[model samples]
Target: MADYDLVIRHGLIVDGTGAPARQGALAVSDGRIVAVGAIDGRGETELDAEGHAVAPGFIDVHTHDDAAVIRDPRVDFKIMQGVTTDVVGNCGAGVAPANDAFRAYYAAGMGPILGESDLPWSTTAEYFAAVEAARPACNVAAYVPHGVLRYNAMGGERRPPGDAELQRMREQLDEGMRAGAIGLSTGLVYAPGAFARTDELVALAKVAASYGGIYGSHIRDESARLLEAVGEAISIGEQAGCGVQISHHKAAGAQYFGMTKQSLPLIAEARARGVDVTIDVYPYVASSSSLAAMFRLGRGAAFETAPAIIASVKYNKERYEGKYVREIAAELDLPIGEAIRKVLQDEENTPSVIMFIMDEADVRRVIADDHAMIGSDGLPSEGKPHPRLYGTMAAVLEKYVREEPLLALEEAVRKMTSLPAGKHRIAGRGILREGWQADLVIFDPATVADVATYAEPRQYSRGIDYVIVNGEVAAEHGRQTGARAGKMLRRGVAT
Candidate 1:
């Protein structure tokens, strides 16, 4: 009998640890890597990878694919970009331990992608069980959503939690951590979670820290107040004694085009002060969010305006949807408030805007920073989605590492794999060492490129010829191999 289930021979291995690339073969047994050097052995299967680069499968640290995972387990958008694992429940939104009422509340933003029958579980544990049962195309890890937790514990009302409410929320967070959440995520720009005072977040984060969980956030603002938001996240990390991850790190809006330089220093200072602060960013300049977020500066105001905006006929103008409110108001000859309302009407109908906010120099500077990791803040539901969903990994490999030479290949791979895995405590992943899980990708760096554009968003990327998830072939020759071999990852004492 063969000593191993599979062997990939003669490939240039970039182990995702920021190490120098090596020319070698890799052996896999069961679902874990057994060897990482020359192995002249008989095997159940052999894949020739000569001249290709084999690295740890890319881990997308930030994504909004909660419903899409159930609706389409293939995860074509990410898989095509060489992503083998995606951490969902980001930006304080997810689908676990939620009832029909909660589902109805978030339907506009999350969509009705998963049917009641499709969701056979409710709690995080049960949700993972269902994911395991379904056998997805890529591994899925999740964070406990602060928005969902607050909504579940305190309903839609936004107020500082009283002693009893705070205690109850703490218990709920504790339960979620025990049930497999990697960390706690908050959306300070979105409702309920936005309503939470900084003290309440610090209190909940303390519980997460006790359980070895990190604290991540979609900050209160990505534009004018980005510096303050970063400061607040750093403060929370300090006060709660927890690691912090700033989700979809960016300085949006023309007003803050070059503010990344100013904001990133706050993160660096926090790290210098002994707080473990990190951030993730997609490759695209345009951000994706509910149309409502553009109009309302605060959470409650956005919620109040969403309905009336959807009702207006003037909102059907697609040309104005992705632009800024002031520009739209000028073009429509309407007041700023009315223009904002007109744009936010139906969440689905409201064309997801692509605000050109960040300067190219700023993008390069932030992404090149050692403390940063790659995150495709990609939402799969939008009709004309951001290209990052299908282009993130390829963009990094092709643009940053190859074309611009802003980052070395090994350094870029670290941002995509090990950095995120280490930050989130994902075990047996993000590395290509012996005894690790055999989640790997083989691609041609010279030819790898992102084909998807904002105008043509559904196109798959190029040059990623093979992707293996847990020792199973998920994508072959840039095409899905119809393998649903992914698993649900849980938090553990050691990773």
Candidate 2:
């Protein structure tokens, strides 16, 4: 005869702990899970989930929605996917702690992701404040960008930090940690961060480690010398005494199709040697990134030789929105290299392209790893964006779990939820136990599928029924109920 605000009954519960599903009812009150199992309770709102699988809401461990959340607080693309939280500022690009002098550099690195928007927050604390004030639809945790730190410490300088400069960067990293950042992220191939050597990253990692923060890296190379990059990421974690997360873990280029075969062992060995390590991958064979990533992946020659490399946005939308680069070159009677140069040399443009760089076997190899988790690596503001934005979680459930039977539902849920929360140390979420935060999703596993494709990239996933965020039914029956119950989940700060 207990009272509750809401109750979901008769559902198969996948609790995000990699435990087997059990039939039960979950009760919620005051935005926290109050009861589970055979609930001898009643509530104002009751949901009959007889045929659905209920699990703790998904957590996107890697994302660039730092500015997208502020601009589009509804965040349908996320909440609809049952993602109750987003971990942003990955790939070492964030928009915070930027002074008037250094803000431009931060903006450049973040501009493609955030778009051309006025950045009012200059520190991690302010960024948190803005997100809270806007009342985002899902929870958000952040990592301070190493690229921004380097830019602030040395403006536009492609050189390793000297002693004084390194100390300065360390101070800023410490400030961000104190401001509630969960960790520090590095895009080792990007400028500023690219200029940083292992010793330099180790120095910055030490500052984050002192705060019990993790180090997430978009490693230097994922194509030719991927093992070396993986080795370096492991080296940073070992030397700095911080947990390491390899972001968007993938081996690009057909020549390097099975590189993860080598990379995974490095991680396993690192873990064996007491270096905490994990990786994330989206459930797609094709990867999308800036033209620069393609260039660095040694696909520059292919941009001219191949037509499948299509221009997605910014430079020429009229003639190249849905066509391949080679097609554009053919129509214009221009050489492939010259056609690519036209797009790349345009300073005003930040174009993103979708390249068929990964093999399905290679993608499956990475995602099937025990140490691997899920990250959409979705680019909201930039380019046409990847279908993973709307499709990643569903695709994993549909393609990997049910269709292929490559992964169990429990383990997949574990990756999207508890695994990430444990790695990032995000408390009070990722599990559906009593006293935990009430972020849950109800979906029809039988029909769960990703409808979004490369040709039409903005479609939402299928079979997601109800999404509850902090005990509020945010999205019910596949549509947003206009509830903004999300909070800024700080590391040590409790709401």
Candidate 3:
């Protein structure tokens, strides 16, 4: 018998550790790396990787592919970009602990993309069981969504949790952590979760911390109150004694266009103060969200209200379908609020908007910072979804490393792999070393580029020649190899 199942020969390896690249061969056996550098032994299979760069498969730290994975495990959007693993249940939205009532409540917002037959599990663990049974194309990790916890414990009420209700939520969070959730996630800008008091979050996050779980948040504001949101995240992390990650870190709106510069200092100070603070960013200027998100500020309503809001005459008159609030208001000769209301009246008619609120310089600065990791924040269900869903990893390699030259290739790879794996505590992943899981990628750095654009969002990327997940060929020659070798990563212990 051969010493290894496969050997990739003569490749320039990046190794995903932010270290300098070196030429070597890699050996894999029984789903883990057996050796690195020269291997004189023969193998059952050998792939000639001469002139290619072998690196750890990209791990997308933040994604909203809960439904997408079950529906189509191929996940061409991620695979084509060399991503072999993705952490789902982002923004406090996911398909877990799901009931018919909750499903109905979120249907309009999440869309009709999911089938009733698709969801056969409830808790996070059960959901992963379903994924395992289905055999997805890439590895997946999940977080306990605070929105679902609050809803399950408090019945979707828009008020501060009473002592009893708070305890129930804490117990539920504890249960999820025990069931293998890596952390707790909250969308403080979205309802029910948004209605939660800071103390409630602190208490629940404290429970998560006790179980070794992190607290990740979609902050209360992305624009005007960006600093306050960051402060709130810091406060929660400090009080809860847990690590905190700001999901899709960005300062939105023209008003806060250059505010990332101001916010970075606050994050730095918090880190200096010994609070574990980190951030994730998708490489894009435009953000993707439901049509209702554009008009539902301060409104504690379920996603079901979206379609009705879009059908209103005020929305049509304002022409808020595909344009930003400022742009629509300008065209309609109306106040921003009026334009927003009109846009909400015809929710289904109103497509998701691409709000160009972030500054390119701010994006570059965040990605280059050692404290930040890359997250797609990509919602795949939308009609005109943000291209980041398909282009984020490629964009980082092409734009930041090659074109704009903001970060070195090795550093960028680290942000996508090791940094995120370390943050999420995914063991034996994100590194190209012996005894590590054989999740790797091989590509041509000179040719790798994102082909997807805002106008043509679903196009696949170029230059990712091979992707290996769990020692199986997942993508080969830039095409899916119909392999389903992914596994659900559980946080083994609650923290």
Best by lDDT: 2
RMSD of each candidate relative to the true structure: 4.2, 1.8, 4.6
Supply candidate 3's per-residue lDDT for 47. Answer: 90
| lDDT per residue (tens digit) for residues 42-105 in model 1 | 6798888888899999999999877677667899888888899999889887777576656666
* Candidate 1: stretches off by over 4 Å: 112-120, 298-340, 346-351, 493-495
lDDT of 2 by residue, 1-495 (tens): 549999999999999999998999999999999988999868889999999999999999988888888888999999888899999989887777677756665455457645555678777788889989999999999999998888878876877888888888898889889988988999987766788888999988999999999999999988888999999999999999999999988887777888888899889999998999999999987776776556655687656443354536665676676567778677878887677666666634466777777778878988999889999988885445678888899999999999998999999899999999888888988889999999999999899899988778788889999999999999988789989999999875545
TM-score of every candidate relative to the true structure: 0.90, 0.96, 0.90
Error at 36, model 2, angstroms: 1.1
Give the range of the ten consecutive residues with the poorest summed lDDT in model 1.
305-314
**Stretches of candidate 3 above 4 Å error?**
112-118, 298-343, 348-351, 492-495
Give the backbone clash total of model 1. 3
lDDT of 3 at 236: 97
